[model samples]
Target: MRVSSSIDSIYQNNVTLAQDLKSFVDTHIISNKYEKWHYISRIKSLESFALKLERGGISSSSTSLDDFFACTIVVENSTQIDKAKDLVNKFCDIKCKRPNSNNFTHKQSSSFEFDDLRLYVTIKDDVTVPNEQIKKIVFEIQIKTFLFHAWTIAVHDLTYKSDEINWGKQRVAYQIRAVLEQAECAIADILNLSKLPQLDKNNKETKALNKILNVFKNHFNKIDLPSDLVRLCSNTSLLLNQFEVKENQLDAFLKAETSAGRGTKMLGLSPYQIVLLGIFYQCEDKLLSVLMGEIKLSIKIVITRELLDFIQPDIRKFILDNSIPGIIVLA
Candidate 1:
């Protein structure tokens, strides 16, 4: 049950390296606004490390424990999985491992297929660990979409670590997994369809929208908004384009409101709520009503004030013109 002292020593020595790698990964993820669901952890406890070594069939004396350190990045959809992989490749040396094949069928193992999206990264050079025996370190970065992560967790709990794995239960688990896989694909397709068309960077409307987005990003301290809220904002850009709200106009409005003590105080709002307010400010009456219906009365009042403060008379008239009776209240 006990791990060798050498293994424990390697683990203890490389803990700092693991933490540093986690921070590095976190920075990249946040800076790129890649995905909101993610976390980093070191391989803790001797039993887990020993189990990993046994699973990989590696000797305690020869192999270092660095590879056990890992971070999981959960993206919104399957498309972002590839994007996450590319992002990780930019900063670290990726170690490619060949798929382990099943001896009976001579096909790649199901376990390998399950983890095909994970990338192994390593610090190529030896890191100096003070008062420790470890010299080099390696870490894992796994990219998974939300549904895929759910499926994996379900499978792990039901099959891999279960006390008794019955054939009937295994069959049922696989069936559930298949349904989840299909659902994942459907969600990815929907996400792709909902995405905004790539606007030309040089276009005036594109530039204006970019500037507004930058302001919101800065205002939120560059926090990654939830994917659903981000998509909502993207959809709202169409209304911004229709209204021809220029960047300078938005900037002046925000400044004037803030200076006049009319801007919504953000202290009480979550980051998503703040982003939602920014998006709702640009929405037409119909779309605005849809968003308004989802929020609480307090949030609705705050958003209404922000909208009234920032929307110009002409833009307000445009929204009024497009308003549907009983659905939108302009007051």
Candidate 2:
């Protein structure tokens, strides 16, 4: 494990170059505000470099350090791989490109391999370095997605670096890698799923949920609806259907709700209350008739402020007249 003085000197210079490159990349690439990117960089240790030199039968004088100063850029997903390459193209001089092995299916066996867009690159000429000689040093830049990066980091030591090969551990590691690979592929296509087709159009519950989403989006200009609210909508969609509460009816109700509250106290209601009140106003008689039975348990009650303050004067009478347990008024 002894490293000669010449090799030690070269490693020291490489350490300096690694620091410079790290600073340069931090300033130019990682500072990009558009995409959320993570960076990892490392310089090969002297012991490891010496081992590689001895094992490859390569002399210190002629061997070029391709991996001496290396770094990895973990992107959001596979879709951003090209965008990351474009950013690298801006600052570095690319010498060679290597596609990840994951891109090609292995007909011989089912296996998981390292996924990377490896770019062998050097610093551009215009960029200044401590030593001009270090500019010629070709370091590697690995562009990988979160999943791929995660899989490599998680499984590398357990399987690849293990002294004794345990097939069970290797199998589990590859299985995990396969899952992560599938996830990366899924992420690549997630944004385009809506463009494919309308498979749920015939389903009544799907239609009702769509109606709820559309109504909320149109009225509140909200696309990211809360999970609880969505669940409430789902649970009540069939009820809305049962009561014959059409989309137009909810739209009309919201319009009136908005118009009535512009210059008054209790100016607006929560989305939860809006849906409940719309159903209440439309189906009060039928709801009151079955207020005490199994029908009561099916209703998803979301307790909010007193309904009397928010309702119109005519509807205020409805709230006053009906002590409908957990319906229009909870108190």
Q: What is the C-alpha lDDT of each candidate?
A: 0.54, 0.67
- lDDT by residue (tens digit), candidate 1, 67-128: 55666778877767667767766656676532332224333434222643556665434333
Q: Quote the lDDT for 114 in model 1.
A: 60
- Which segments of model 2 are wrong by more than 4 Å? 1-5, 33-35, 57-63, 100-111, 126-134, 165-168, 190-206, 220-248, 259-331
Best by TM-score: 2
TM-score of each: 0.49, 0.63
Which pairs of residues clash in candidate 2, taking residues 3 or more apart in a chain or in different chains? none
List, residue by residue over 229-325, the lDDT tens digit for candidate 2: 6775765565565566775566676676566552112336556566556555556666555454435534545445554455556655655665555
lDDT of 2 at 87: 82
State the lDDT at 67 in candidate 2. Answer: 73
